[model samples]
Target: MLSKRIISCLDVRNGKLAKSVKFVDTIDIGDPVVQAKKYYEEGLDELVFYDITASSDKRDIMLDVVSSVAEQVFIPFSVGGGLRTVEDCSRVLLAGAEKINVNSAAVRRPELIREAADAFGSQAVVLSMDVLRVEPRPGLENGYEIVIEGGRRRMGIDAIEWAKRGEELGAGELVINSIDADGTKEGYELTLTRMISEAVSIPIIASGGGGTPEHLYDVLTEGKADAALVASMLHYDEYSIDEIKDYLIGRGLKIRKA
Candidate 1:
């Protein structure tokens, strides 16, 4: 099996590392730059950074902070939030992020995804979807829908169809953030994740509700995700990257060793 990636996520709000439960009740945590460096040194496989409020606030990401965090880690770094156009993505890549994720902007104009993929190879373009479980509809036969503006706006787009559309539009990967699971640390929405992962040909990174090593394993194996985007458990230092990796290894999962 290809080694599963253990990615640490740093959600920022107004230039400070923050945490949120169900996409609300956000709280400042610490300096993201410090945490980025710390996690890289500890052998993290990858790191994802998000200007969580940028989409809601309708502003660009803080390049200074993105640059600062990029400077701290040499691993694969991805950034998102307030990134709308190809130029915005270019600025971020130039600022040092390896990948640029588009959410609200891409949904507003899907051409942006194709444009970005054309400008900077598809490998650099990530489609991040915030999903919420809802009643089934014609297009959303799965009962899962897409939400934007940090879970404040319901897009009415079906998650499965959206994933396929993102791949067709040249998105290299998909990060599915379950609104109900966000910050819950209970466990991931495995059925939601597995459905999307199987629906798309690209890799799927399961986000939200990651509380323990077992949760990570479940999402990667049974959930059929290619990676696990972790925040709370790591943000509070509840478990070290190495500790998590060791547990996955013991459970017989092929993981990129920390």
Candidate 2:
């Protein structure tokens, strides 16, 4: 079995690292470059840098920050936000991001996924989906809807269907973030994560609502996620990468030991 990966997420807004509860009530955490270096030193499997407000604000990603963080961290790093075209992906890659994550852009123009895969290879393309459970309307086939623009815009797209489509479009991985549970620490939305995981062949990185070491294990074991992405808990010093990895390993989950 492949060892489950524990990834640290840095949500960069206006060049600063920030965290929020349910995607609101934002609070500045620290500097992205410094934090990225710290996580790399602490032996994190991978680091995810997201320009959280770029899509909503309709601005490009912070290339300077990206370049700095990329220089500091030797592990794989994935960057996202405000990437609208192949050129945008090229710029991010040139900025030293090993992988480029696309959410709104891919949803708005799915062909961009193919374009990126063709230009940069599928392994360099990550499809990020911000999903929320909406009230079941009478005619809706799926219970969940995909929201874009930093979860500010509701597109009425089904989450499971979108994951399958992204995989078909040559997306190397799927980032399933549950907006309803984000930063709540209640645990991951296991049902929704399992749906997407089962629907897609590519690896799925489950994000949002990871409040404790047990929460991380729950998603990786019970939720059947290939990897787990966490922010708030780690940012606030609630847990360390080694601590979480130890806890998961103790619980019989296969994890990479640093």
lDDT of each: 0.89, 0.87
Compose the digit string of candidate 1's lDDT tens values, residues 121-146.
99999999999999897877899999
Question: Among these predicted structures, which one has the highest lDDT?
Answer: 1
If scored against the real structure, what TM-score would every candidate get?
Answer: 0.95, 0.94
Task: For residues 69-101, write the lDDT of model 2, one tens digit per residue.
Answer: 777789999898888899988988999999999
Give residue 12's lDDT in candidate 1 (0 to 100).
81
In order, how many clashes per candidate? 0, 0
Off by over 4 Å in 1: 53-61
What TM-score would candidate 1 get against the native? 0.95
Whose TM-score is greatest here?
Answer: 1
Tell me how many residue pairs clash in candidate 1. Answer: 0
